[model samples]
Target: MTHVPIRVGIGGWTYEPWRGSFYPPKWPIKRELEYASRHVSAIEVNGTFYSSFKPATFAAWRETTPDGFVFALKASRYCVTRKVLAEAGESIARFVGQGIVELGDKLGPLLWQFAATRRFDPDDIAAFLQLLPRTHEGIALRHAVHVRHDSFLVPEFVALCRAAGVAIVYAASADYPAIGDVSGDFAYVRLEDAREDEPAGYAPAALDRWADAARTLAAGGTPDTFPCVAPGRAPAVPRDTFVFMINGAKVRAPHAAMALIERLGAEPQR
Candidate 1:
């Protein structure tokens, strides 16, 4: 009856500082994803945001990582950075048809990020959501949206996302608004408050707290203390949870992700 799982990791694998601290001394640059995927259950890939990669590249990535590892890709800027979001169908189609299915089951959620200046226009956002294809190349796709503007805090936006089955990313950042409402069957969390001083990137107690939070999310429950746009709660049902240690104190992100993985108990990334 267990239909939920929690995945924790960092954004991307390559970092100059992690060469020694996170990776083995003088580890081969080409095998960084292979190494990173072993230590964590999931990784949020940022490279897809600016450009496109051939199917072979995605296939190679899948072969390098372990069986249970999952990679979440950021949607292309071309799809989210335009004035007319609804008109992005062509761009969205290009990105979706770009042979990403090469990753097979290793592929996870696609994060669509909007500019901070972009306010919540219910109709525009809804149109853009409709443009997102539920399935591509016979593979089911899960979508998550990240909005930096505070104007997205309105209940209307939350209700819209909920109806569309697209997750609203819980961005734990001082500059962006955090919405912990469960809009989809899955939960996406972007933690951006890592500290340089803490070796684990976060205090021990903080990691413990996040571990608990992740458990709650996987169990189809939202933390009551977290910020929410909607007044009422969604029906609690088992949900897969994804948490990535991102931005803030970027250098310490890997450590923070590893810490979370350790706390969650390494059970072969299932």
Candidate 2:
């Protein structure tokens, strides 16, 4: 079996609730990213979704994390929430040009999340996907689209992503449409819907189930665990998997992420 890389992490490391529990008590706020980096292989930067960050900030982030730690950035809403997808090229370029290259090899996929109101338009989506640069600052870039509307679950959309080599995010949530289509070379999953009452967000059995699903994904097979709207399964080609424990019980995300990492038999970046 091919040894596919599996990364498990939470949305962001700056949550106040994690200060005392996940982070050490009285730990310097400046060192939060450093602390979190020691426990997880990757982190999804949610702040970038709201605003663009400076190159120095990106450099600082890369410096704080240990080697091999990946940072998956949530693309700015300004780039994806526009009325005309074709007009978003400049905004997309601005977002990408704003120091993302500073992260260097630590940069993982860029997640382009669309609002629930954004319906599927083949031409519009195709144009937006085409605008995504294959490389940024001389480094290859990986793109993932997180579509919320059910209209995006069609086979045509899947084909578009496959052609563009953009991953279709496997979002697991009751409120959002979960599409388990594998359209790109890798798989990106957002495990949302965790329960606050559950200490680890997901029960042990559920974690085990997710681990099995991750293994299946690594082997290039789509797990039947979620609702797949696309026409067929992903080809059995070894691929990397990014599993993020987000939303739901936000406070438990770290624990859940760590549990998933353990289940995958992968070591944290410490």
Candidate 3:
């Protein structure tokens, strides 16, 4: 079992003015990334949706980060388009073969994010998931599926990932519907923007709730696989989870992640 502390990372983009209230006024992409990297163990790149990454970009990222730092790249829109699996099979294969494989060791999991409008079609989804390449020796990477709609948050939907050997994302948000389903061992949990006005920053209460849930899952091995979506506050590495924080205004991921590292680090060694 790996004892690495929870791996946390900020969401890809932090440049949004976001209602005119964020630091630096002008978020420098590279700088923000470097800062987050210094504190968190991994980051999820949400930029691959609109633009194709040049090999140089991946190489530059590798050059910029430390050895253990990991990157979870979102599969481009082109790869997860609404087209049928058969239609997009070649594109998927090509993207993985050309794009992700090129990332070398920095690559973590390839995230397959389904748009809100993209409803789950059992037949289509099953076929699409089946088309994804399985484990490879070159990189011990797997695919993580994130659904941005209410319909895909059910047991059946989670089961799809389990059957496919993929991880399903657990997102935390004020606007989204409740998360009642616990799908796979490797799950993804995200703690979105809370607020600085209110009791912001992964409140101790929230952490306790999550920690309790995590312990339950850990003990029973219920959600056998665990990846995480987060405010960079959730634990991942040592516990087999992944955390991504999309909320940067009220709570900086570095601050929250460092706090979490200290807390987890202080726990009695087991």
Candidate 3, run of 10 with poorest lDDT: 229-238
- Regions of candidate 1 where Cα sits further than 4 Å from its true position: 1-4, 267-270
Higher lDDT: candidate 2 or 3?
2
Q: Estimate the lDDT of model 3.
A: 0.60
Q: List the residue pairs that clash in candidate 2.
A: none
Superposition TM-score, candidate 3 onto the true structure: 0.75
RMSD of 1: 1.9
**Runs with alpha carbons beyond 4 Å of true place in candidate 2:** 1-4
Candidate 3 lDDT tens digits, 15-101? 553212323555565566555565567778888766777777788787777666778888878877656654678777666765565
Which wins on TM-score, candidate 2 or candidate 3?
A: 2
TM-score each candidate.
Answer: 0.97, 0.97, 0.75
Q: Residue-wise lDDT of candidate 2 within 44-101, one digit each (tens)?
A: 9999999988899999998888877899999999998999988999999999999999
lDDT of 2: 0.90
